[model samples]
Target: MTIERTEPATDAAERTMLEGWLDYHRNTLAWKCEGLSDEQLRTASVEPSELSLMGLVRHMAEVERGWFRKVLTNEDAPPIYYSDEDQDGEFHLTESDTYQEAFATWQAEIETARRNAARFALDDLSEGKHRRTGEQFNLRWIYTHMIEEYARHNGHADLIRERLDGSTGD
Candidate 1:
């Protein structure tokens, strides 16, 4: 299915601006993967890299869960697709994974992230520490980091989508 992207407003409050840009990037990822078959979605178009459109969807879902649910809300959310033994599972796809399910899970996680974020002000600090750095952070930092994360992954998505069908755009 095709996903429609809404451009961020040029002028807005800090919260609105952050959320709008994030939503734009999120939709861009979906648009990049839209209307493709399961095989197409799973194609590691950029050889030597394990990245795939489907894997990206899964990765973003995990990212949303981590920053929003786990860090922001201090919820005990586990990884959706990875483990210690398979830390990069989000970028690893098999024939058993379905694009429909990945998209649904990603969308759900997005909604959950929004709900979790709505509970706190931008300056509110997380109760949990960063997994790697062991440093605490605020909601504002999380929002900015998530935007950067999606922006970077969306670039990868653009390349993969183009390789799959020569399609390209914002």
Candidate 2:
């Protein structure tokens, strides 16, 4: 599948700007993983760190679920790939873990995030609070943070992809 990432509009409204950039980053991550084999997707970049393209997809799926479903909508959405006992379960892939499943789950979470965010204005407070500070967050803040999160992870993805196949771009 071709991942066509459009540039965020410069003259758009605040919400459009935010959503555009967020989706851009989302697509960036997807593009990074494009055309790679299952073994390549599962290959780690460096020693010790278990960061892989597939793992990033799974981790982002969890992030989307946590912020959008569990926090924004206050739904009883448990982690699909992780738990308290194994905080980074998504990053720790098994022999059965596949790119198709990880990407499908991530895309599903993104759809749910869009639906949840559509119900609230940017200034609306999240139904759930921060796990660390116990402070509630506005949708604007959530959007901004999610953009940052994806941006950071996408950088890692870029490196991993480069290491895997020497392909590089935004």
* Local accuracy by lDDT, each model: 0.91, 0.94
Q: How good is model 2 by TM-score?
A: 0.98
Number of the top-ranking candidate, with lDDT as the measure: 2
Query: What TM-score does each of the candidates earn?
Result: 0.96, 0.98
lDDT by residue (1-170, candidate 2, tens digit) is 99989878789999999999999999999999999988999998898999999999999999999999988888999899998999999989888899999999999999999999999999999998867788889999999999999999999999998998899886
Distance from true location, Cα of 76 in model 1, Å: 0.9
lDDT of 1 by residue, 24-98 (tens): 999999889888999999999666988899999999999999989888887999898999999998888989999
Cα lDDT over the full model 2? 0.94
- Among all windows of 10 consecutive residues in model 2, the one with the lowest summed lDDT is 128-137
lDDT at 160 for candidate 1?
A: 91
